[model samples]
Target chain A: MTCEDLDRRLSEGARAADLAAEPAVATHLARCPECARLMAWLLRGIGDVRVDSARASEIARTGLKPVRSLPPARTLIMSLAAIVAGVAGLHVVTMGADGWPLLSGSQAIVFAAFLAVTLALLAPAWLSSLRPGARQRVHPVAAVLLLAAGFPALAALLFPVRLAEGLAAEGVRCVAGGAMAAAMASGLLFLVTRRGYPLDWGRTGALLGAIGGLAAVAALQVSCPRHEAVHLALWHGLALILPVLAGFLAGRRAG
Target chain B: MASPEQDAVPPRTGAAGAREALDAELLRLMPRYQDADRAAADALVLTAGPVLARYFYSLTGDTRLVEDLVQECWLRIHRARQSYRRGEPVLPWLMAIARHTRVDQYRRWKRSSGRETGIDGLVRQPSSDPRPGIENSLQAREVVAVLHRLPDSQREVLTMMKTNDMSVEEVALATGVSQAAVKQKAFRAYQAIRKALGVSRREENER
Candidate 1:
C-alpha cells in the first residue's frame, strides 16, 4: 500500500494500520514525516472524531419525504430568455410598431441587437440565483445594474436629444406602459424561479424586478413611436430601476 | 460519528476503494432523498456526518461551531434539496450548502457583534520558536506545522480532500470553481506539506 492508502486507513480510524505486518507501509511511514505525524496521533488514540447521532437526525429529518429536483440550468435559463422575448414581443405587437418607421434602419438594428444580447447574457446569471452552487460569470445584481446604466447611455447615443413639448407628460405615458410590462415580466420570472433556493433574497428579488424592467424597455423600443433620448432615458430608465428596488425589498421580506 | 447506515450503502468490490464506494452510495441516496426516502436520507446523514464535521472543524478549528454549522447545514440542505440535480456528484451539492451555512452564520455574527473575528483563531496561533517537528499534534491549527503557511484557499482544498477523500471533480464542484483551480490549490498545499515534512526528515537524518 502507498502512503495515501495509509492516510485513508488512518482516516478510517481503528483497523487503520499494522505497521509491523506491512513493510511498504512501514518504510513509507519512516520516510514521510507528515503521515508519520498523523500516525503518531493515531497511536495515541485521539485521531477519531466522534459526533452525536442527534446531529444526523437533523439531516435525516429534512429528507423525510418525496420531492422533485429543479430542471437543468439550460432549461430554466432558456425559459427566462423566452419570457423576455414573449412578453416584450407580445406587448410590442399589440401596442403597434410606431417607433420602427421613425428610426433609421441602422438605428433600429443596433438597438434591437443590444436588447437581444442583454437578454442572452442575463440568462445564465438567472440560473445562478436559483441554485446555491451554480456558476456565475457575473453577479446578477451587478449585471442588472449595468444594464440599467448602459441602456440609457446607449439610447442617448442612438436617439435624438431634442426637447419635445409635454416631454414629462408623454414620458409618464411611456413609462406607465413600460412599467406594466416590467411588473408582468417580474411576476412571471418569480413564478418560473419560485422553487429556487436563493441564498440571498435581496439579490434574487432585484433580478426579478430587473427582468420586468427589461421587458418594458424592449417593448417600448418598438411600440412607442418617439425616439427622443431624454424620454427614453428618464422614463424607460425608471421603469427598470423602481422594480429592482421593489424586488430587493420584497426579496428581503420573503427571506 | 459512524452510524448503522455506514453498512447500509452497497458494499464495494474489486477496484473500488471505500471512499469511492461511499461517494457512489451518496450519489444513489440523493435521488432517493429527493423522492422522499427516509432510509436513504438517514444513510446520507450518518455517512456524511464525519466528513461535514471534519470540513467545518478543519476550517474553523472550533468544535462547538462545527456542531452548529452541521446542524444549520442540514436545515438548509433539506430546504434546498430540490435544487440538487438527479445525477450530479452529491458531495459538491452538500459542501456548497455547508459553505452557504458558514457564510450566513458569519454574516449574522458580524451583524450582531459589530466586530470582525478573523476567519478563525488559527491566524492568532503563537509562533514563538522552539520549532516543533512534524510529530506535533494533528489538531486543526498544527496539522502540518506549516499548514498556516498555506493561504486559506489552498488550506481549504487540502482539508476538504482529507475530509471525504474527495477527487478533483468533487472539490471543484463543492468550491464552485474550475477543476484547474482546484488542482493549482492542491498542488500548492502539497508543496507546503512536503517542504515541512522534508525539513523534519533532514533533521532526523542529521541526528
Candidate 2:
C-alpha cells in the first residue's frame, strides 16, 4: 500500500483501538522509519499521559464519605405524588361554594385530556433526569412552545363564554395565587431531582415549571368561582408562563 | 518488510486486557461504594482514578486543574451513585459527570473573571524540564498541542476515543450524539492531526 493509504488505515486503527494497530499495519511500520515514527508518536502520546498515583489515591480516599441519593424514578414518582397531594389539599381548603362543578361535565373531559398531554410531555424530562443515559425525544424548547400554545387553545375550547362584565380587576389575585402554587410545586420538584445530574437544566426546569403550572390550574379550577372564558384564558391559562420563564432562567444557571 | 525486532510499537493487548479487568473490578465496587463501604470506595477510586484523571487532563491540559477536576468528578460520582443502573458501563457515566463538572467549573471561572477561556486556554504547555525519557514527553506534548488546535467537538471526541479508550458508542452516549456523528468527529480529528504532523515533518525536512 502507498504510505498515504497505510497512514490513513493506521490512524483509523489507532483511534478505534488506542494501542493495538492491525497486524498488517504493524508489519508495514517495521520496514518504514517514517511510519514507525508516526506510530511511535501516536502510541506514546496516548499511553504516557499518566496521573500522579499518590494524588489519585488521596482523592479516592474521600470517596469513603457517605453520600445519600434516591433513585431518579423514585424521586420523580414522589415529586408527582407530592404535587398531586399539594393541589388536592389546596382544593379542599379553598374550593368555592359551587364545589367542583368543573369535575363532572365537558370541563372535566377537557381537563383530563390536557392533563394527559402535560404528563406525556413531562415524562421524558423526568425519566432523563433519573436515568443517566435516557434520551428525551423532544427538545426542551419545542416542549415549552407546545405547552405555551396548547394551554390557551385547550382553555379556549373548554370555556367559550365571554361574560359582558369584565373581571380584569380579579386578574391580579388569580395570577398571584397561581404563581404561588406553581412556586411551591416547583420547589418540591427541584429538591427531589437535585441528586440526579440533569444534562439539560432548562429542559428539566421547563418540565418542572409546566408540572407546577398544571397543578396550580387544577387547584384553581376548584377554588376560583369565575367560569368566564376571558378570565380563565387571561389569568389561569397564562399562569404557566411565569413558572416556565423562571424555570428556564433557573435551569440555565443550575445546568 | 524489516524484522519484527525492529518494530517500534510494542504489543498493546496487555494494556487493553488490564483495562477491562479494572473495569470489571470497578463495576463490582460501585454498589459497595454506594452503600458507604469505605474499603470498596477506596478500591473503586484507586482503580478508576488514573483513567478519570487522564480523561480530565485531556479536556484541560493543566495538571493542577486536572487534579482538582478529578476530585470534583469523584464527588459528583458519589452524589449520583444511587442513580447508576447495575450492569451498565461505568466509564461513560463517570465521563458524563466529569464533563458536567468541567463545564460548570469553566462557567464559574468565566463569570468570576469575565474572561473568555475556551478549551484552548485549558491546554497548558507540558513541563519543559527533561526527566528520564524526554523524547516520549515531547511526543506526548506535541500530540496534546496539536489536539488543542482542533474544534471543541472534534477534540472532545478524539480525547474520549484516544485518551479514555472509549468506543464510538460510549463517546456518543457520553456526548449525547449519534454513533455516526462520533465516528465522523473522530475521523475529522484524525485527519487534522495527520495534516498537522505532515506539515511539521515537511518543515523539519526543509530545515
Candidate 3:
C-alpha cells in the first residue's frame, strides 16, 4: 500500500497482528522496517506519563473547613418562645366576628375553588426556578402567604374593628394591620435567610394567597371605614402579602 | 530509507525503571525540602514550565509566544487551586490544567491575533539557517501535529500515556474507562495522525 493508504489503516485501528494477517500489509511491513519500529515506539510511548501523587495530597490539605454545630439550647428555647407569642397574638384577632357576618355555605366553597385554580397556574413556575445548590425545599412564597392570611384574622379577635371619625380610636384596625405587617416581614426574612433553599412553590403560593384572600374577606366585613382593624387585617394584609409572595415565587421558579 | 534505520530497535521495557527513578526523585525531593516543600512546589512548577513551553513551541513553532503562554498556564493553576480535587496525582492534574489553559490561550489568540500561527508548522523541522522567523523556529518545535489533529479523547489518552508513564490499564482506571477502550481510542488517534501525514505504519509491529 502507498504511504497515505498505510496511514489510513494505522489511524483506523489496524493492529500489527491484523496487518500481518492481511497479505498486502504483511508484505509492506516486511519491505519497510521503519513503520514497524514506529508502531513499537508509539506503544511504548503511551506508558510513560504519570501524575505526581503528592500534588493531590497537597490540594486536599488546603481546602476543607470544619463544619460548625448548631446553636445552644437556651438560645433555641428563647427563639421558639418569641415565635409562639407572635403566632398567638395573630390567632386571637381572627376568632372575633364582631359585626361582620361569617360566610356560611356557598361563599366559602367559591373561595376555595378560586384559590385552587390560582395555585395550579403559579405553582409550576415557582418550583422550577429553584437554584441547584439550595439546601431547603420549603418555598418562601407559601410561607409568606400563610402568615399574611393567618396573622390579621387572629389580631381581629383581640382588637375588633371600629369605624371612627378620624385616625384616633381606630384601635382594632391598627392592631390587625400591625399583625399582618409583622407576619409579612417574618415571611420575607425566612425567605431571605434561606436564600439557597429550594422553594416549594405550590405550598408557598397557596399559603400566601390564602392569607391575602382571608384579609380581603375581613376587610369587607369592616365596611369602607377609615379606621377598622378588621378592614386593615383583610385588605391591607392581603394586598401587601400576596403580591410580594407572588413576585418572589415567580422570580425564583420562572427560570 | 531513513525509516528502516529508526525502526531497527524494538520498544524496551524501561517503564519499570523510569517509574522507579521518578519515585526516587520525588522521595528525595520531599524529605530534603520538607520544611520548604511549598517552595519546592514552586520550584517544581518553575522547572516544568519550560518543558511545556518548549512543547508548545514545538507544536506552534512560535518562539516569541511560547514563554508568555507557559506563564499564563502557571497563573491559571494558581488561580484554580480551589476547584481542583485533592488527593489525586498532582502531575496529571497539573498537566491537565496546563493543557486546558494552553487550549484556552490558543483559542483567545486565534480570535484576537487572527491566523498568524498556523497548525501546519507544528511538524515541520526548524530551519538550520535560523535568522529568527516563525519558519526558522520550527526545528525546535515538538512535532505534536499528529496529536493536535487527533480527537480530544485520543490526544488526552496519548498525553497520559506519554507524559505520565501510565499503562493503558492505569489510564483507563484514572480516566474511568476500560483498558480495552483506551487502547482502542489510542489506536484510532495514532491512525488519524498517520493518515493525515501520509506516513506508512509499517514499523508499528516492531514492538
Candidate 4:
C-alpha cells in the first residue's frame, strides 16, 4: 500500500478498533520506518498522557458543603394552591358591587377556560422545578401565553364597545393589584424551586410569571365589575407583561 | 491495498465488559454522595479525580491549571448534587458540569486578560530539565504538542474519546449534540492530527 493509503486506513481503523491488532497495518508498519514512526508517535502520545492525583486527598480534606435538598413536589403544588387562595381572598375583600358579573353566563365559561389553560401551562413549570431534567417545552409556554394575552383582544372583536369607557382611569389600580399578586406567586415559586438546576432558567421563570399574571387576571375578572372589552384588553391583558419581563430577568440571573 | 474488512477481527469483549462494570459502580455511588455522605463524597473524588484531571490536562496541558479545574469541577458537582437523578449514569452528568465550568473559566480568564488562549496555549514548550525516563520520550512529547494544534471542538471530542473513554452516545449527551456529530468530530480530529504530523515529519526530513 502507498504511504498515504496506509495512513488513512490506520487512522480509520483506530476509530473503530485497536490499531495495534490490525495485522496488515502492523505488517506494513513493521516494514516501513516512516509509517512505524507515525504509528509509534500516535500510540505513545495517547499513552504518555497521565494525570497525577497527589492533590486528590487535599481536595477531599477541604470538605464540601452539603447540597441543599430540593423542595418536594407536594410542597410546590401546595404553595400554588395557597397563592390561588390569597388571590381569591384579596378579591373578596376588595371586589366592587359588580359582585358576580363575570361568574355568570358565557363570560363564566371564557373565564374558566382561561384559568384552565393558565393552570395547565403553570403545572409543567412547577413539576419540572421539583424534578431535575424535566424541562418544560418552550413552544407550549409560548402558545399558552399568547392565548392568555390575546384572549382579551379576541374578546374585543366579539364584543365591540365605546372606546372611552373610563377604563384608562382604572388602569393604574388594576396594574398595581396584578403586579402585587404576581410578585407574591413568583416569590413563592422562586423560593420553593430555587435549588433546582433548570436546563433553561428563562423558560422556567417565564412559566412561573405567566402563572402569577394569569392568577391575578382571574382574580381581577371576579372583583372588577367593568365588563368593557377595552378595560380587560388594555389593563388586565397588559398586566401579564410585568411578570413575563420579571421572570426573564430572574431566570437570567439564576443560571 | 488490503481492505480493512479483510484484516478486521472481533473486538476484545473482555475489556468492554470491565469498562461497563466500572461505569456501573460509579453510577451507584452518585446517590450516596448526593445524600451528604462525606465518605461517599471523598470516595467519588478519589475514583473520578484522576479521570477528570486527565480530561482537563488534555484540554489545557497545564498541570497546575488542570489541578485547579479539577477542584472547580468538584465544587460544582457538590453544589449541583441534588440535581442528579438516582439511577442515571453519573459520568456524562459530571462531565457536562465539568465542561461548563471549563468554558466559564476560560471566558472569565479571557475577559480579565483581554487575550485569547486557544490551541497555542496548550502546546507545552519542550522542557530542558531531566524528567522521568518513560515520560521524557521525545516522540510522545512531539505527538502531544501536535494535538494542541487542533480546534477546540475537535480537541474536546478527541479528549473525551481517548482520555475519558466515553462512548459516542455519552459524549453526545454530555456535549448536547447528536451522536452522528460526535463521530464526525472525532474522525475529523484524527485526520487533522495525522495530516499535521505528516507535514511536520516531511519538514524534518528536508531540514
Q: Rate the local accuracy (lDDT) of all candidates.
A: 0.72, 0.69, 0.44, 0.66
Give the poorly placed runs of model 1, Cα more than 4 Å off.
A1-48, A93-97, A137-142, B1-16, B121-141, B144-154, B178-207
The deviation in Å at residue B161 for candidate 4 is: 4.1
lDDT of 3 by residue, B53-155 (tens): 5444434434445545566655554443432222233443345555555565655667676776643323233323333322332212223444556656676
Residues forming the 10-long window of minimal summed lDDT in candidate 4 chain B: B127-136
- lDDT, candidate 2, B12-49, per-residue tens: 55546665776789789877777778778768777887
Docking class of 3: incorrect
lDDT of 4 by residue, A125-185 (tens): 5565444334333343654467566667655854456576566778778888877877777
Q: Scoring only chain A, what TM-score does candidate 2 earn?
A: 0.71
DockQ metric, candidate 4: 0.24
Residue-by-residue lDDT tens digits, candidate 2, A98-173: 5376445878777767766766667565666654554445555666677678877777777766864657767777
| Model 2 bad stretches (over 4 Å) | A1-45, A52-69, A72-75, A78-82, A85-89, A97-111, A131-138, A156-164, A198-203, A221-230, A250-255, B1-19, B126-136, B178-181
Give the per-residue lDDT of model 3 (tens digit) for A1-255.
Answer: 854466555444344344546878767767765555444434432111122324423542343333222223244334433443443344435534343345435543544443344434323323322221111233444444444555565446444477545443454454455345335433543342232222233444444334333333333333323324555554445444554556446534631
Q: Give the alpha carbon lDDT tens digit for every residue of B80-155 in model 4.
A: 7777766777777778777777876776677787877763453355332243321334553464466677888887
What is the lDDT, from 0 to 100, of the residue B123 in candidate 3? Answer: 27
Error of 1 at A73 (Å): 3.8
Record all residue pairs in model 2 with backbone atoms less than 3 Å apart, i.e. clashing. Answer: none
- Better model by lDDT, 1 or 4? 1
Candidate 4 at residue B63, lDDT?
A: 55
Residue lDDT tens for model 1, A1-255: 666566444333213234524777778878876667655533332133435646667566753677778987778877888888888988887888888778899887887787777766667667877876666666676678678888989989998798888888878888888888888888899988877787778888888888888888888888888788988888888887888898889998887
Best by DockQ: 2
